[model samples]
Target: MVKTLSRANYPDLPFYPERMIQFGEGNFMRAFVEWQLQQMNKQGLFKGSTVLIKPRNQGMGPRLDQQDYLYTVLINGIMQQQLVNDREIITSVSRLINPYTQYDDFLRLAENDELEFITSNTTEAGIAYDPDDRLDNGPQKSFPGKLTALLYRRFELGKKGFTIIPCELIDRNGEKLKEIVCCFAHEWNLGESFLKWLDEDNIFCCSLVDRIVPGYPHDKATELEQELGYEDKYMVMAEPFLLWVIEGPEWLKERLPLAKAGLNVRVTQDMTPYRERKVHLLNGPHTAMVPLGLLAGLETVEEVMTDPSFSRFVNLLIENELIPMLDLASEELRSYASAVQERFNNPSIRHELTSIFLNSISKFKTRLLPVMQRYHQEKGQWPELMTLSFAALLLSYRGDRLQRQDSPEVLAIFDEAWSDQGTVAQSILSNSNLWGEDLTQLPGLVESLEANLRQLEVVGSRAALEHRIGVM
Candidate 1:
């Protein structure tokens, strides 16, 4: 009979003191951060466990507690051109506390003198200000609110401050979280001393985290259980490639010994290049690939990256068209782009194209637009592949082929682009408020997008891409 994965099944394993309070207990944290902590513990560079704060009442806390906060992380991806498929049980987390249910327990974690660091990945929308959140509530609805309450408790108990790192996808994630926390300090009337303590005591590190964690291998769980001889409901699947670049004081390098473990963590003075690399190379491709891949009948990133024509098109776009404009080293850009390709080809994680298609308009603006404009200005010619991708972006906004998740303003803009009977392409390109410039002024860009759109309608995304392979 298969048994549940818990300490009762394996009694010899050691548990360390909980030193880190992770605000979000999701797959990304377990697979990415805690996995590294497990490695750090083995090397004696770090001997600390994690206290979990379930961001939402998502109901995973009770299940996690039953298993002694243990879960397996399956790593599947390429390393040195070799396919690696591996699994390990992560025991670096000691307790799971739901602020929604165990608010007192959550607040009590602040009393532990060993609590040194805080990490969070509460999704892109979680780190925001809600003026309605009051300090008196058992648990505030916002992530920052709960955090402020916990910080206030720490202040009251005269505890040491924490080093906070937020893994939200926003630019300057740590700075933004601190901004909202300070906002709460003022709104909640937590006193000037508390504000002074927040400013002087805590260290907020702006970080860039890259790992494809396709959480909870539900489809392969039965097979995996038969192989492991234990049932693991919270098992997570992730790529082998990991990069955590955090910008903070140089002293953090001494405190966090993740680098001593020979892992991919970097405590740096500047996180700008790493941030740009992620947005332009990794995220840019994803945003550009969404409509193109989805309309081409591709289901996942693995399929798109392995298909001959599609694969070549993406490689060419990043290497030749995108990175030429970036200020970072060409060799570094190539290396990062190569890793991105390996990540996309990881078979275990099914990175759905539709998921990346959410908020494509703003994503395109942030990831691809700047590169496209810079390439044009510097080289005196429009970059063809990304321009074509722009065509895909505009066409994708119609909400026809892929599942659409965008603001109504974005939807209405696309509606106007499609509804304009005179010149759909010109109408969009001339809207300076949207694109920040009249794209029609660029030589052949308007014509290029117009032609690509026509080809997409006539021959479909695959055939259009196949034909364009011979052009650029």
Candidate 2:
């Protein structure tokens, strides 16, 4: 019989006061936020636990409670080109509350004097304004609405406000969340004093979080459980690499004290440079490689890096096409680019090409399009490999080889555009709605795209890649 994980069975587990209220009781919270808190506690930099609140009605709160909020975080991936395999039983989460079922208890947590921070990762869509949410309701349907009501409860008691660090993957997430909360406050007629309190008392710091948490390793659960000598139902698997960039004042760092724990977290006044580095260097290459890699008959990101032709394509695209166009430091860009290459080749990670190929149009718009436009502005020429990737993207959407995993609206547009192959490049590139700008206006874009598409058609992706290499 397997031993259950709980304080009763462990008997030597340490406990701390609940000083933070975390929204979203999912694997990310467990693997990233809670794991960091536990590390801080272990080093004596911080001595507090988190009370998790499930953002939605259904979640893993009950399951977590069953295990006494104790779960193992298995980290398996590459770091600095070395294999890392480690696991730790995280104990920072004190308890969990589902607002829908325990609304009064959820609001009651606001009155706790020990509470100083509130962290959330309710996803990008979770921060939106739902005008239908009401303060008087048992539990507001939206995360912001529930938070607004809780804050009002704290204000009623003249308590101090929280430093809210939202981990939502949106531009200016903290600002957007505050804006929605204010919208709710005004709609509920919470008065000018509450608005002032909301503005002055609270510190909403926008944050960028990067970690791949593959939760509940079911395939290896039995083996892992046997190795641990206990049964853990909420075991989470995550990559070794982690980065959390929080946009806040310097004082906030002292309050959080994550650096004292020796974690890879940065609390800065402006996270713009860091955000740009990630978007341009990390994400840009990931998007650019997908369509081209798929077209070249590659299955995974590892294959792209291992193959000589594809590897050269990535290096040239990053060093020549992407890095030269950015405003960041060249040395820093080069170092980051090197790390990205290693990460792409991580043996533990099998990042499927087709998965990244999902919604290629939108991804290309955000990640690679800017680089293409910038290169054109500075060098007076469109990027060669990027243009080819764009052309390949158009080809992929013709309902051919790769699985079409985008919106039906986008698929329909492509279907209509591909009907007339004679003007397909012209029709797709000129659409402002897809790219947010008339790409056809860019000098020589359509011509280059037409030429690349023709080469891909006549010779094929592999042959075109070889030809592209020979020319460079």
Candidate 3:
């Protein structure tokens, strides 16, 4: 008989007070943050549960609660060149509170005395300023607005503010989150006392989270359930290699004890180096690969990694070109880049190229644009491979070849660029509004992009990619 996963079935299971409130109870949070906390619990370094608050209504809080907040995380990858397939039921999440359905409950949670740390992974799009959201509404639609109301409640209760750590892929996510919340305060005309409390009480820490949680193992469900002897609705799958770099003070280590728990978590004053490594090496490559790879006639990340032409193209771009532009040591950079390649090639996980293509224009601005600029600054020439990727992006928007999920404003710009504009490549490049600066003004960037775009259009991305390598 398959016994249910709950403390009711196995009473020896230990439960703790809710000390942390995490937003966005998605797969990454489930497999990475929540699983890490479970480890911290096992080591007796921390004895605290998490109160989950989803960023939006389209979440699984109610479903998670149905099973007593019990779910399994399957860590899949190659460890020491050996296949590692491990699954553990995570019980760190005490309950999932949907702020939309139970706004009062969500607001009341702010007054919890033990809650000191707040973490969120609302994806790239969740953290934003929605002007229409009013303070008096049942639940402010945006994450930042919802957070501001929660913080206001805490301030009213005289509760010390939380250490807000955002795992959003954006740079300085913590700082950006705080900025949005402050914007909310000003927009809503919340109060002076509230403003002062926010300034003095809260701590916003930036972070970089690198983990490929392919989410539900839908394909291997039957095999997994038969193996585990119980059905888990919220089973998340991820690679074994996980890293969380939190930009925080010396006190954070004392509080979380993740380092003591033997987890790959770093608490430092600045997480910029780690962030850069992830953004430039892992994320930047992904952004470049998606449009080009899709056009190259590849489906999954593993496909691109396995393909000799596409794989070699990315490795050269990262190692030979992009790495020299960074301030980090070559050894560390090489190791990170190598690890990324390994993860990309993981046989167990199939990372769809289209999934990574969401908000691609926004992704390029953050992930690849800076590297392109720095490379131009250092080498005084266009980074040809990176330029090829940019050309792929512009060419993608020129037609319906690649499906884009960028913001409406961004889509509008690209729509116009691809339309009646004769010199569309140079025209789009001149829009500092899009690329953060006039990319056309960069020496040889526009010319190089135009050349590559023309080549790619004529011969397709795969052939162009191979031809570029051959010419090099």
Candidate 4:
């Protein structure tokens, strides 16, 4: 008989009281947040478990149920100059509840006095105002709508407050979610008493979460299964590093104990510095390097960073153009940037440029454009790296001549915008929709970017980049 792995196999683990109601059952949340909870429980810092809510119909709810709410998390990355591969059976998720089907059970979860926290990763588009979503609407249309009904039900049963932590990758995500929930409550005419309860009782916490969780490496399952010695249908693979910054009141920290567990988790009043560091250093460089790296004949992040020319190009792009625009300390920024470079150089993770090339237009607007604008405003001159990055981005959409793979959808917009125009570079740079504002209005931005784009079109990506760095 096969020795089936059970809780007895992990006798060192701790069983905790279920206290958190997670709104999304996706891998990012499971591998990141729930994993942290498990870490805390083992250390005796936190004694609360999680009850997962399937906010969407199509997710891993069935798989999660089949696995008895347990999943294996594989963490692989460099630590102390050695490649560390650790696997943990995540049993912190006590149960899974699908509200669409099990509405009564879902509503009853709200009345559980032990439940003190609610968390969600409903994606950026999940939080919205749906006019048709009423309190009586069984299984509401939006995330906030469902949440509003739950909160009202909780309030009615008695004033039960929970700390709301939203992990959506949006600016002030918690605040935006709170605003939408309140709007839904008012529109539904769920009573002024409920609104007062919302104001007085609940806490909406803005949080920043960072972890590259590549869920379920199906291709490597045979090897992974042999290593783990058990079949985990909901296994998730992620990098070693993880950061969760919660912007909430100090009292909540006393309950969470994630810091006590020695994790890189912070409960802070102001998360602005953390946000700035992440956005400018990590996300900014990633966005800027994707097209540049892809066009330079690199397939993966490790390949790009391993190549001397492209690596140096990426470094210069960050140190010169991007760092000068930020207000953070030079040494701190450099340290973070260095770590980012190392993370990209990790041979274990195969983070692809094609995967990162989603919604390029919006990404450029959010990540790269701000730096471009700031550099122009402060220095009175356009940065070459920023200009080159934009040029490479525009050129990326023009379809690769060698590979014949089309650029992403947003890139298609740029292609059409400049199709009927004589001066392709000038036409693209002048488009308000693409650049958010009229780039022609900026003194040297249009000219520099246009010139770079022209050079890239003529000389190609590698040569154009070399020209910018004064090598060619």
Candidate 5:
């Protein structure tokens, strides 16, 4: 019989003062930030624990508490051309507080002298300004509002402010969070002294984090429990690649010496280059590949990466089209692109093309649209493979083959556009709501998309890919 994982069964765990407040109790935090802190603890480079507060009313706090805030992080991927499968028992998190139910306890944490850092991974929408939030609420509805009340609590207690680093996927997350927090302070009529303290004392650092955490290995739980002689309900599985780029002063490195511990964490004055590299190379390709891969009848990223025709087409897309548009060192971009390709090819990670298909139209707007525009501006022609991928995106939204997971409005627009009376390519391209700007404004884009759409229909995705591969 397997026992439940708890500190009672493993009493030799090290303890440290809770010096950080993490605002999310999700799997990504368990596998990424908390795991890094654990590494720092083991190396004796940092002797701090994390207090995780549920960002919303619902979370995994109770289950994590049941396990004594201990869980397993399973890393599986291709690293340095070798397949690596590893696991570690993480113990950096001291405990979790559900702010909705334990609001008093949550505020009490703001008074702790040891608290120095705040990290959050609330989704992109979590950082927005919510007019409905109030200062006196037990727990504010928005993440920013909750933070503002806590900061005000600290201010009232004459306690030092925290160095806040948000891990949300939005660009300049630190700035956006601070913006909302200030908005809350003014809306609540909090005095200028508090605003001064917020600006002068606290550090708001924007950070970019990259790792594909697939959360809870449900399929392998039984076998994994048998191997360990214990059951961990919070066990997280992730790819081996990890990167955390924090844009902050150089002195911040001493506080978080994750790089010194041989991790890929970097602290710099400007993380713009890193952010652009990730968005254009890794995220952009992932978005572009999904519809095309799904249209080719490939279910997972592994299938697309391993297939000859599809793989070559993606490689050409990155090298021939996307890489040339980026404002970074050629060798560095190529190295990162190579690493990204390896990550996509990792067999242990079965990234479903359809899963990546969620919010794909918006994703394309953010990740690929800018580069496409830049390429057109510089070269005076639409990129062939990228245009073909756009065609695939339009076709995938027809809702005939795959389940569409987008806004009702977006789905409806596609449905109407693909109707027999409407021209799918031109209609979508001309709708400014879809791509932010009318994509038809770009010369040759609509024509190229129409041509590619024709080819995709007549020859299918694989054959279309093969044609591009042949030309390249």
Candidate 6:
């Protein structure tokens, strides 16, 4: 007989009342939010459950339902000079409702007076405006539209307010989402009573979440299956360290108290410091190293760290380019930066550079350009690592033949740039939209970046990085 894994096997797990309505059912939410909720349930800090909503048609809803809303989360990383390995069965998700299929069940959730919180990670693209989206549409096309309809329904049922937390990567995500939702309501002419409820009663929180969840490693299924000793079709692998910072009122701390539950979560009035720390140390280094490191014939982050030249290049980028631009204490920034490097060096996790290289142009503009501008305006000199990193980025965008293949659109952009081929360095540096401003006018940035680009084209990525850093 085939043994089945059931809740009875895990008797210590608690089942609480459902009070949360989550809008996305992807791996990040599963590994992060639901995992945090399970911790809360275990500590008796919050005795509420989550009702998951499939915001889009394509997701893991069917597989999740097949497993009876149960899944395994594996945490792996370094802690106190030891490699920590642990797993838990997350069961806080009480119900999964697909609005596209069961329209009545989806709308009826709005009338539930017990609902106190609404959480979402509907991806950046999900939150958009669709003019055709109406109040009567069974399931609205856009996330903002669907949310507007749900809030209106709750307002009609006597203004039952809930805390709204959005985990999208956009800045001021919560406030922007709320603004868009209200815009939809006004566009639909949902009436003044509903607008009042939206403005006064609800709490829209901006949140910053940090964790690396490489979802469902299908290639290593056999080994994972043997290790787990049971089949888990939707198993998720994530780093051990996690942080969730919510920018909202003090009431949230009293209600949730996630820190009291022994979880790495904080409720604060200002998330700027935390946001800056992550963006500058974590995301900034990742992007800066991708092109330079990958072209050095290194495939993964671990590989880059093992090579002395590339490793030092990354450290210099963080210390010189990114760190000087921030107002945080040097020791605190260094500690966080060290942790980020350790996270990158995890042997178990295989974070691909090609994946991070997607939308390279836009990412560079948003994440790194601001720091470059600040350093130049304040310090009167170009940040060497950042300038060279920009050169590497432009070269990476120019397309490489030996390393790997790129997207056709990416190839096309490079091809167009190559066809003109008139002072390739100057042409690329002059593109204001890419650099967010005319880098040509920035004191030494354009000249330094152009010289580095020439070096990259002549000697290659690794040698160019070493040559620049050696001189410094």
TM-score of each: 0.94, 0.97, 0.88, 0.93, 0.96, 0.93
lDDT scores in order: 0.86, 0.88, 0.86, 0.81, 0.90, 0.82
The alpha-carbon deviation from the true structure for residue 159 of candidate 4, after best TM-score superposition, in angstroms, is: 2.9
* Model 4 lDDT per residue over 302-334, tens place: 887887777888888888887777777888778
Worst 10 residues of 2 by lDDT: 58-67
Full ranking by lDDT: 5, 2, 1, 3, 6, 4
RMSD of each: 2.1, 1.4, 3.1, 2.5, 1.6, 2.3
1-472 in candidate 2: lDDT tens per residue? 7898888899898999999999898888789999999999998888999999989988674667888999999998778878889989898999998888889899999779999999998988999988789989859988899989999999889998999999988989999999999999999999899999998999999998888787888889999999988999999998887789999989988999998788889998888877877887888888988877887789999999899988898888888888887777899789878877877877767889888888889988988888888888988888888888888889889888778899998998899999975678899988888888888888899999989988988888878877877788
Residue-level lDDT tens digits of model 6 in 109-157: 8888888999999998876788889989869988888888888888888
Which 10-residue window in model 5 sums to the lowest lDDT? 55-64
Ranking by TM-score: 2, 5, 1, 6, 4, 3
- Which structure among the candidates has the greatest TM-score? 2
Cand. 6 Cα-lDDT = 0.82
Collision pairs in model 4: none
Of 3 and 6, the candidate ranking higher by lDDT: 3
lDDT of 5 by residue, 1-472 (tens): 8999899998998788998999988999889999999889899998999999888887674788899889999998898799999888898999999888899999999779989999998888899898999998769998999999999999999988899999999999999999999999999999999999999989999999999898998889999999878999999999899999999989889988899888999898999999989998999999988988888788998898888888888899999999999988999899989989999999877888888899999999988989989998998888888888989998889998778899999999998898857567889989999887887778888888889989988999888878888987
lDDT of 5 at 59: 61
Give the CA lDDT, 0 to 100, for residue 77 in model 6.
77
Q: What's the C-alpha lDDT at position 103 in model 5?
A: 95
CA deviation > 4 Å runs, candidate 2: none
**For model 2, what is the error of residue 365's alpha carbon versus the real structure, in angstroms, after optimal superposition?**
0.2
C-alpha lDDT (0 to 100) for residue 401 of candidate 1: 72
